[model samples]
Target: MDFEELYQDIVLDHSRRPRNFGELAEAQFHAHGDNPNCGDEVTVHLKLGANDAIDALTFTGNGCSICMASASLMTLKMKHKSRAESGELIHAFHDMLTAEQESEPDKRLGDLRVFQSVRRFPQRVKCATLPWHALEEALGKPAGGEVSFSEDTAG
Candidate 1:
């Protein structure tokens, strides 16, 4: 199959059977994000281990295929990564989708790069990113332990 087809299949697979698609009983951080325009909502749960590495990551929510697939891919990519590394990757992923010049996807993004085509659809962009925004919020408020992101106020 062609690369485009392969990418689509991968996304479909993840969306249909998302990995890490639940809550963490031992979560150290948690955050929720929603896109009011599309009604996509996601919550990220994190548990940090030694050296600030992600011991576990999971999510729970309902949204479009793009949103679900992105959340699944994000859990797989961020697992075992240090908080610092995950932070950089989060920025890189956002840049990949929002860059004005349509640049190459960062190698660090792994299969998460499959969503590059999402940039073409502005609305889909928010769908794919809602999970990441929640992850960012989770990572940022370590002390608070919980946070929320509403696209209405994100501007």
Candidate 2:
């Protein structure tokens, strides 16, 4: 099968049976993010080990298949990575999913590379990124997180 087909299968599988898909009762760090435009909301919980590695991570919420699958894959991929490494990964993933042109993904991104297709639809980008933003906040108490300004024009 072509890579897009395989990636689509991966997304479907992860969304239907998400890994680390529930709460983390022993979590040491946690945060929630919402994309009101798309109604994608997620809460990320993390437990850190010594030396700042992520010992465990999980999340809970509802949204599109892409959002759920992204959260699932994120938890799987970040299991033993240091917080610093996760931060780098966040930037890489954001860049990959938001790039305007078709581009090769970083090999280090592993299954995360599947999300490269998300770059095509600007609206869906927020669905795929909501959990990630929460994860950044979870990791950001020590490292400042970036502010995502909404376009709401209310005074």
Candidate 3:
């Protein structure tokens, strides 16, 4: 199959069998995010090391295939990474998902290139970004502003 087809398959497989689709029993940080447009919601849990590295990560949510799959993939990628590194990964992935110029590629995104197509669908952008936003919140960063989606949004 072609690259597009392979990417679709990967997304679907991850959605159907998400690798880190649950809460960590002893998480050091936690946060929630919601895509109000689609009602896709996710709660992310992170276990951090003394040095602020991610020792483990997990998530629980209900959303489209893209959202769930993206979260699963993000958890896998974040393991053993420092908060700073994970933040960089989040930026790289965001650039890959939203970049307009294919010529100026985000090399750090790696296999996350599969999400490059998501930029075309404005409504779906939130689905692809919910996890990263939640991660930021968990790290005590101000994601955007004091904007609230639902009281259901929490860490």
**Pairs clashing in candidate 3?**
none
Model 1 accuracy (lDDT, Cα) = 0.88
| Worst lDDT 10-window in candidate 2 | 146-155
Candidate 3 lDDT, 40-102, residue by residue in tens: 988888777878788888999899988888888888888899878888888888777666665
Candidate 3's C-alpha runs over 4 A off are: 1-7, 100-104, 141-155
Please estimate how well model 2 matches the true structure, expressed as its whole-model Cα lDDT.
0.81
What C-alpha lDDT do the candidate models reach, one value each?
A: 0.88, 0.81, 0.76
**On residues 4-34, what C-alpha lDDT tens digit does candidate 2 reach at each position?**
6435989999999999988887888778777
Weakest 10 consecutive residues, lDDT, candidate 3?
A: 146-155
**Winning model by lDDT:** 1
TM-score of model number 1: 0.92
Q: What is the lDDT of residue 16 in candidate 2?
A: 94
TM-score of 2: 0.86
